[model samples]
Structure formats: C-alpha cells, structure tokens
Target chain A: MSGLSKKQESLIKSLYTRHGRKKHNLCICEGLRCCYEVLNLNPQLVEIAVCSEDFDLSTLPAVASEINFIRVPQEKMKSFSSTVASQGVLVVAAKPEFSKSDDAPADPYIFVLDRVMDPGNFGTILRTAKSVGLTELWFTAGSVDAFNDKVIRSAMGAQFGMTLREFSDLDVLAEELRRFGYNRIFRTTPHEGESCFTAPDLFEKTAIIIGNEANGAAELDGSLSLTIPMPGNYESINAAQAATVILFEYVRRSEGGA
Target chain B: MSGLSKKQESLIKSLYTRHGRKKHNLCICEGLRCCYEVLNLNPQLVEIAVCSEDFDLSTLPAVASEINFIRVPQEKMKSFSSTVASQGVLVVAAKPEFSKSDDAPADPYIFVLDRVMDPGNFGTILRTAKSVGLTELWFTAGSVDAFNDKVIRSAMGAQFGMTLREFSDLDVLAEELRRFGYNRIFRTTPHEGESCFTAPDLFEKTAIIIGNEANGAAELDGSLSLTIPMPGNYESINAAQAATVILFEYVRRSEGGA
Candidate 1:
C-alpha cells in the first residue's frame, strides 16, 4: 500500500468543512465502522480508503480490494481524524446526489427539518429516519450540513442508505410536498396541538416537520400542529428524542398497534 | 462582583473530571441555559455563578442575587468553559445526592441504564426520562459520569431536576427493584422479545433497562426483553432514540390513547 500523498492529505483535511466538501463533491467518513459501512453498502462512491499501519486489513470487506487503499502512520492518521480516538481508518467518498425528480413512487412519509442546527440532533434524527424506513430526508436552508463529520459519526453511517434533499425556502418545500400529493403537513409544538399518539393519518401522505432546537419549526401555512404530551410538564425534550418518539409512533401505527 | 480566585479557578477546571467532581462534591453547569436552569429550579445547590463582564445580568432569574456572582473577562470565561461557544455564564453547584432510603412511595416506573458510555446518549436519555415524568434514574457502574460537562449540556440541565442512583452490579440493581415492588423488569434488545407497543404492563410497577450503546445490556437474570419494532429493518436506531420511543410509549399508554 502507498502512503497518502501531500495532495491527498490536504484534501482529507478539507473534507472537514462544508465549502471544501461541496467544492470537491466528496465527504469524509472516519472510524472503522463508517469506513466499513461505505465499503460494504456504497463502495462505488468511495474514492480512497486510508488506514493506519497497525490497522488490520483482514477485517475489511472484500470490496475494499477494489478501492484505492493508503497506509499512513498512526500519528498521521490521528492528525486527519476528527474524533478524539481515531479508529485508524477513514474513507473519502462522493456525496450521494439526489434531485427533486428522484422521488419514489407513492412515497407516503417524509421528515422535513427546518434550521436544525445542532449536529448531534441532526445526525440522530437521520439515524432514526432511516430506522423508520424513510428513503429520503428534506432540510431547510439553515440546517447544519448533512455531510458534517460530527453528523456522520452521530448518524452511525445512515447517510449511506438514504437520499438527502435541501430546499432553500419553506414555501418552496411546502409547494413541492403538495405537488407530490403530501396532503398532510404536521409541525411539532411544545404544547397546544393534537396529541401525536391519536393524530390521524400520520403514516399516510404525511410530511412531519421537526423544527430548530430552540425556535422550533417556522410556521408552515395550513400545517397541522402536533404535540407529544409531556405529563411531567417539562418545557421540552431533546429535539432528536422528540423526533424519534414521533417517527416511531408512525412505526407503531403502521404496525397496526395502538 | 469579584473576579474568580486562583483556587476557585483551579476547582472549576477540575470539575471536568469525575474524580474532581467527587472530590469537591461539585459539578459545573456551563452555558446560559444550564446556568439559568440551576439558578431557577435548584437555587440552593448553586455555590457560585460566574459570567463574562458583558453577560446581561437582567436576563438572570431573580434568585441570581442570592448567590455569589463573579464577573470575569470574556476570554477568561472561555478558558474555563468546556463548550466551543460559551454562553458567557457558568454555574458551579453541589451535586445533588440521593440514597437508597429516598425512594418515592408507590413509584412504579424506573429507567435503569447498563453501561451506557456515550455522554450524548446518556444525557439525551436523562432529558427524555424527565419529559416522561420520571423522577429518578439508575445506572450501572460502568456508565458515563452523569455530571460530565458533555452529559450536562446534552441533558439540557435535566440533571438538576432528577435524582440519580448508581449500583455496583446489575444483581444489586435488580434486587433493589424487587424490594421497591417493581416486578416487571424489561431489558431492551435489538431483536426478539415483546414489541414495546404490545408489551403488557410497561407502566405498572415496571423498570426498563437501556443497554450500552455497542454491546447492549449484559444478561439480567429473569428480566423480560423488549424490542422496538423497526419497520425499516435497519440494524437499530440510536440508543437515546430507542429509549425515547419506549418512554413516550409509556406516556401514550398512561394517557389512555394507545
């Protein structure tokens, strides 16, 4: 295996920023689990896989052989890593592209995020969205970058399995949703809305909007508001946790359970 | 308003570690939200409140006048903060203490955590637990320190409002649960066991076990296993997300909806 060249090193460092990732059309997936995930599930998008000298090659999947592998010293790998403890492996892959024209036939549910700035919350929401069988995610303009390394790590590689779409304006997103036959648009509020458990038609032609961590969703014209009843009367739960509860309620309802 | 003393500065820095927190019987709450939380909700616990010179005093709760408030330079405040962007306010409070004798009468629900190592997950779980009206939490020995700054930030100061109990062994925890009349002990699993929605008696005299993020719960003898049905058939949702779904299901059932 060859060592990473100076050009490659600079590129890997640049992957940490949104402008750089956009400029190169590439994102970095660090740690052994993410690297393995990209290799196993989306190998075609991977351009290079870098491993520290001590990293075991046998543990890699068969698809690793088809990709360009670079061996670097442990110290060098640490420098390129975003995590406190580097797992000795990293992968640079093309950002999966999804356009407005790529909608699946009769897709009933979509999770729309508006200005969700926290990386951990954004990533956790992605992981939950994927768990609930969502094939695509929509984000408003002010949301954190989907390809951020912290988001990637928190998501545990869910980005590999889902399509992400960004909309510059909420009005435009609402228009597109209506055009796609999503008749029910729901926004979560801390209080004073339909109880999520009893909210009808959550799994049918629905788009649930999870708002920003602090400010919450921008008012969507004609959108129904839903609230998860907090008997404890606490102000709110974590944004990601709230999204998970609502999404899984969709799962619970779809499974024909109460 | 006086600047922090050298000894006080050293103590605040040490509060970042479990050892130091234990030694001082104190924990640090950084950022304006958390500091305000401790000040407003648990005022007696606040030992010292520190803020950058430019921090607005009018925004603080009325109780701020009862505590020692220190004014420091913005740069100095940053030096003592654990977050990327300090909110210009930090509070050092005595860690809330709870013991075996403090169990609430007829308390039917308890969330037990087994070796949950991720600070973000632990904190998110704490936030969800509080939202579900849970007043106490139990943790296995290997779990992350509940007072760690990252945990505090993710929990959004939920720690100030709940009681925490840590056990040296799962057996001891189970025994404690039984003594408290918690007959139904449920451990979450990625697969198998009863579906959370259909699980009988989840809200009646129940204790739910959330496992470690990676390896999951260590086998608890006689514990019933429960699973969140994933329609997407993804490997699993995030641990915090899973806990949220299950906890809110408790809310749903109690509300007589599901």
Candidate 2:
C-alpha cells in the first residue's frame, strides 16, 4: 500500500522550523478538528493525512475532496505529531503570505508581538486577535515560530483566518506598519502609561505590540505605551491575558461607543 | 546527604490531587519564581525542596529562614515534580482556606470557576483573578484541582496571594456567595445575553463565573450572562481569555471612572 511520501512527511515536519517552513512555503495544521476548520476556511490546504484507524471518510469536510487525502497507520501517525495528544489528522497548507503593500481593511488593527517565547501564549494571542477581527499580526524575529506545532494547535486554526508576518527586526516592522497606514503603535506594558480604558481611540489604524512573557515589549518604541491599570497589586497579567484585554477593548470601543 | 523525608516528599506530591491537598491542608508551589514568591507572600510555607545542583542558599527568600529547606538530588527532585520542566525548587505551603463567612473586602469581586478542566487555564484564571485584586475564587467540585502542579506552576505564585475555596457543589457555592453578600453573579459566556461593555456595574459586589473550556458557564444562574461582543465571525474566546477580559473590564469600570 502507498504510504505518505517521504517528501510530504518532511514538509509537514519542517513546519517545526522557521527555515523549513519558509523554504517549503508550507506549514502543518494538526488535530482532526483544526484540519477540518482550516480546510473549510482556507481551501489553500495542499493535503491532509489521517490515521486509518480513526479515519471517517463520511465526516471529512467538502474541502478535503479538493486536497490530497492520505491515510497512515495509527502507530506511524504518532511520529508526525507535534502535540502530546495527536488527534490523528494533519493538514499541510501553504503559508499565507503578507507584505507591506497588502491592503488594510476598513479600520484595521494590527497586533505586533516581540519575542513571545511560549507557543501556547503565541497561539492564544493569534486566536484572540482573530476573534476581535484583527486582519493582520506581526511578530519580530525573536518571537516563537507561529507555525510551530504547539502554536498551530493553540491557535485553534485562527492562523488560516488572518495575515501573519514575521519581521526580521522591529525597526523594519515599524516601517512596514507605517507603510500600511497605521497611525498609532501602542506598546502594551504593565508599568506607568496611559490606561487602556482611557486611551483616546483604538478604533483607528493601530498596531499594538505585546511583549515577551517575562520582560515586556521594552524594545518597542511605539507611539504610545498603554497600561491595563491593574489596581490589585497582584503582579502583572500574563502576556496572552493582557493581549486579550486589549484586543477586546478595541472591540468594545469600536462597537460599544466607548 | 540526608534530604527531604518521605513525609515531606509525600506532602509535596499530594498537592497534585484534590483529595490529598484537602486532607493535608497544603499545596505545592513549584519552579524557582513561584516558590520564592509564595514563600514571601504567605509565609505559611512548611518547607522548601531544592535540588542540590541548583541550590543557591544565598538567593533563598527571607521567609525560608522560618521554614525547613531541604536539598535533594536533581534526579530525585524530578520524581517529586509534576511539571515537565521543574525549576528544581518546590514550596510546600498551607492552602489559603476560605469559607462562607470569610469577610469580603470593600467592593469585593469574586471569581467562580464551574468546571474548568484545563489546569493551565484554571491556573491562568487564578493568576488573572489575583491580578485584578479578586481575593477570593470559588471552584465547584468538577474543576481541575487548583493546587495541581500544573495549576501551581501556571499561577506563578498568584495562588498564594488569593483565597481559594473548592466548593463541593455549585448550588452550595452559589448559596455561600449569596451569604457573602454578592448581589450579582455574572456568568461568562461566549454567546449572547448582554455585552460586558454595556452591562450594569460589574465593579459592584459581584461574583463572576467562568465555566469549562468547552461548555462554558451554562450551569450558573447569574443575574446576567455577559458576552465579549466579538464583531468577527470567530467562534469564541478561550475560557481564561474570556475571564481576563471580564475581570479587567471590572477593573476599568471601578478604577477608570465608569
């Protein structure tokens, strides 16, 4: 019986590395649910691999018909997994490319991440950004690879719903955001700054930078440094939690007439 | 080369189980940062376990002087650990006990977790609740053990800063909150009811219920079920993310002059 080709397996595994993903122009989306989700939303998927034991051909989404569907032994499928709990389905999809010239949507909000190391946090930020209708997200060089298996899983397939770009440097990213007509760059911090609750407006063309888990976006020289105004003295919030607070604040201001 | 006794090791490991934690009235705080933090905040810690290889006695927190500090072999320490990446220090501390009659602080806000299964999410919620100045968190029986090693590590020592109560049942928990004078129970849901941005007075004497990762707070009979109001077609925010958004919104309303 024909098995998953060596080239295909290598491509899926290569998504674990930035170099591999960039070279192949492909990233792996794993878990049966995420595969179906990404495939449904973005039919740009090249192929999907499923364990024969868990394969239910009848439940495969319509988009799966448009892409190569390969079956592998249940035991063999584990080797290709990036997660501890593999759902036995993996999708190989083309990386959605975004550049400086990509047109911004009406009232665009961009999320910039600087050296966020935790794959779970990175993915949750991506999912939260997508939930708030953020069309674009940029990460500086030191940030974790967004296409890493853990991140892809944590993102819950939000990667397929938005534009993701990794810049080599913050200065380069700042220039790119400026080119894209972002008028404000708000760097999220836990320290002294304008309270996010009282910030003038987040509805305009803006880029929000959320920093690393330990040391925040100290490197980013954004136009405004926004703080969440934590009165509790219980230490600062986590990166992803802070990001969601700000993301939904944008949603609140835009929709609730704050 | 005598190290942690069998009793001490057993106590630390017991925190991984709800029954064990409750029986001993103790919980484990793992990792270098959280161990030091919990020790400094609670000072009720009974002991500290450090791997001899990673031990820097000079860097130990001032509170360590009041407790037993044992040095174990690195390999032995791993056996006692619940985390994949233990930082070689774990604090055995008394759990902060709360009951129905525990006095609420002025304008007290309580966080209720119905059946949050994910330890990481539960821990993040605890950290967020602490960060927002919520001194009390109530968890019904089915939620993940708050003192589980993963929750303790994920909480980053915030567990020591707040009062944690695991109620045997939601009805009992609800009755207890009412006795504590919480006028409203705001259940967090991803679906529609009331926009949190437009909801009336989340900063008052309130208890916010964050539910399981999948089913949400369907069990809570809150005065109002609050939604984040996602303008995008994205499915829903993660449990912890939704809780943080609501928690900070309460902060914003209270501190930012709503």
Candidate 3:
C-alpha cells in the first residue's frame, strides 16, 4: 500500500548530500511524537513520509490534511532514519524561528551551545529548554548539526517550534545577541564560585552559553561561575547534564518569580 | 619500525570484542592523556602501541619503561583508533579492582543507572561518579557494556579503580541493595516530590537509580524526586548529563563537606 514516488525519493536523497539544513534552514523530523507536535502546532511542515500501509490519519488534527505523506520503501526509511529505531513516520519541517514573538515573554531568555558534539545531548538540552520556555537558541561553530537524524530522534519532538541558527564564527554571536538586547548572558559550569541553585536568575534579557564537551567555551571568559564542583574525585559531569542542572535551576527560579 | 608481534596484534584486536573485555579484564586506553593517566597511577599495562616513529617519549614518567612498546602499521593504528586525530599512542591497561578499597569512602555510596544507552553519557557520568568517589556503580540489565571503547574514552581514564557490575536481573540488585540497608534509595525527576538538595541529605549505603534515555527509571513508587532543569535551556539534559548532576550532588553532600 506504500505509494512512494521516485521523484520524492530522489529529492530526499539529494538532501542527504547537501547541507540542506544550513542552506534551506530546515531539518527532518521523524516518528510519532515529533509529527504529532508539528501537526498540533500547525507549522510549515514541508512534507510527511510514511512507509507503513496502515498509516493512521484519524489521530491527526484536521490541519493534518495539509501535511503531505509520500510513501517510501522501509529500506529507504532505514537508510534515512537518524535514530537507531525507525518508527515508520517522518516529516520535513521548517526550522522554527527562535526569534522572540510578541506572545512570547517580552524579555526572552536564550540558550546557546558552542560545538556540543553529541546529538543526544543536543536534543535533550533542546527538550528541556523548550519545556522551560526558552525562546531561542543559537549554535556556534563546532556544535553538532541540529537537523542530524540522531538529534531529531533524541529531541523527543521538541523541535516543532524551536528556532535555531548556526554561526560559523561563534565569537560574533555575542554582538548579534546584544543587538537583540540579550546582553545578560550566563554560562553554565560545574566549576564555579556560586552554586547553580543560587546563581542569578534568568532575566527577560538573558542568554545562557553552554560549552564544548572537553574544553569549556572557547570564547567564554567572564562567566558568573568558574568553579561549581566540590574538591572531589569526579572532575566534571557531562556537559549536557551540567547544562540541564543549571537550566532547570534557572527555570525554577523564574517560576518562583525570582 | 613496525614490530607488532602476531600475539600482540591478536591481543589488541581481541579487545575489539566483548569477550576480550571479559576474558582479559583489561580495556584499551588510547591517546596521550589516557596513556599518561594510566602511567600516573602506574597501572598493570598490557603494552603500549605507537603509530608514529616521531612520537616523543622523553617526558613520560619512568614507570612507562615497564610498558612494552609495539609499533604497528600506521594505517592500522588509525583504523583501530577511537579518535580521528592522533598523537600516535595507545595502551591496554588492566581494569583495576573496583572493589571498595581503603581508598573507597566508608559510607559506601553508589550510583545506579536503569538503562543508560549512550557510551558518551555513560562514560561522562562514570567519570563524574568516579570524581565524587562513588566507586560502587552497578548497572541494570539493559545498560550499555561499561567496557565499550567509547565509554573508556569518555571516562577520561577515570575508570581506574572503579567497580561496575552488570546484573542479569535488576531484581537481584534491588533486593541486594535493599538488604544492604539503603533505606534512602532515590531517583531524580522533574515532575516529582522533593528537590535533590532538599530531599533528606543522604550518606552511608546510598544508591541513586537513574533511568533509560526515553524513560527515566521505572516508577518503583518509593524513591523519586521532583525533576529539575540544568538552569539552562534544556528541559532535560541527556542521560549522561542527568546522571552527572545527580551523582555530583550526591558527591557534594557526601564529600563536599557542605
């Protein structure tokens, strides 16, 4: 019952060879949750691809009619799957603009990563940031490709309305965020003078910069906390975990009306 | 200069398989930092392999003399390497006895993962736990093999002198730790009850059970916490990150003298 067109197959295959994400500002979203999320949000989804014959259309909202589901072979699905598991569903969605909107809080808090190498870490951070109402995130050189298939799967569908921009020269992003008045930036560190719990809360105009896996941020110098861990055997936690602990604390403080 | 004996080649290649890690109880440590870290502790090294003739060994500690040096074909070294970039160094070192040595804290705190999947996350968390002196880490059935190359690399040579046990059934572990009087076994969750810091500070025979990537540990209904963020954008950090945050907090309370 699959009705995949050769033309569509060629299109996505062409996408694999090119930096379609960097060039076109889009990435592929796979599986049930991500598709459902984008469907619920009614965003600009380029197309939906399905390999199963019994693909359900009823669970989706009426706007789902607008979603294009081209059929493809399961083999092709395996080849295209970013996740180790193929959930038999896929969509190509426009990368959301992290740029703040009027309905979004007037003072937007942002998260930025510099060359975080793991896709799972990247996705988990995105999922948490979205839950906490982060409006935008910018990636600097050395970060993983956000649209990477592994990232799509690991994000657990948080990419639906997320906005992201990758800058080849990350050092320049500080000036750019400043243009948007996101000048109060905080960097997350396991080593820091202040505990993550009591660090200054995220103001409306804040940008949180996370660092590389091994090295701290290449450009980060004067972060609020330089050493957070106790003198102990464990030198540092995973970078993504460090970011999550600090991010959640920021959100907690924000929620408490800090 | 290529003097890799057939026996040496087989031994190193055996490490590529799981049987190798189990049979020899040794893992391959590659790159300059790991090689030196192994040397610093003066581990029972199997041998040292170098791909380049120009690699300077003058500054390495005198303990390195006991290490057998085998120069392999450069192309093969590149093939076996976990990292693409190379300083032309690799060593196979015995997995130090992870049992609670006198070095182990008397309180005997442990960290647990239900089903952590990523090698990097597992490695990073293992490193964090090791840093915090939580050397007694036992893995549930579905967790990744602790001795995998990526995990070894990510642990940053911290795997030394650590105990990791894989139980065929978590029931045995749950029963065992329970018998051991870990009355305060807890799990970390953003959705649940107590904050980690506020949750009765734990010491002496404690276990922190972290869950899988998609599902945090199963709701054993007894030990859970209010999930929190990293004070960054992520609503959740990757499993590695989550484990790091939780494990280090345990470290801080136990070792931080806070």
**Candidate with best TM-score:** 1
Prediction RMSDs, each to the true structure: 1.4, 2.9, 4.4
Candidate 2: tens digits of C-alpha lDDT, residues B39-150: 6677765445555566775565776765656778788878877767656777777766554456654446677899899988998988888887777778888898777768
Whole-model Cα lDDT of every candidate shown, in order: 0.85, 0.77, 0.65
DockQ of 1: 0.86
lDDT string for model 1 (A43-136, tens) is: 8988878989888866878878776788888999999888889999999888876654646524478889999999888988998888888888
DockQ of model 3 vs. true complex: 0.31
Minimal lDDT window, size 10, model 1 chain A: A98-107
Cα distance off (Å), candidate 2, residue B116: 0.3
- Give the winner by lDDT: 1 or 2: 1
Candidate 3 Cα lDDT to native = 0.65
For residues A45-122, could you state the per-residue lDDT of candidate 2 as single tens digits? 554455556677556578676555677887777887866766777777776655445665444667889889999999
TM-scores of the models, in the order given: 0.97, 0.90, 0.81
B-chain TM-score for every candidate: 0.96, 0.87, 0.83
Q: Rank the candidates by DockQ, best first.
A: 1, 2, 3
- After superposition, candidate 2 runs with Cα above 4 Å error: A1-23, A55-60, A65-68, A99-107, A220-222, B5-25, B57-60, B73-84, B99-107, B220-223
| Top model number, lDDT | 1
Fnat for every candidate: 0.96, 0.82, 0.39
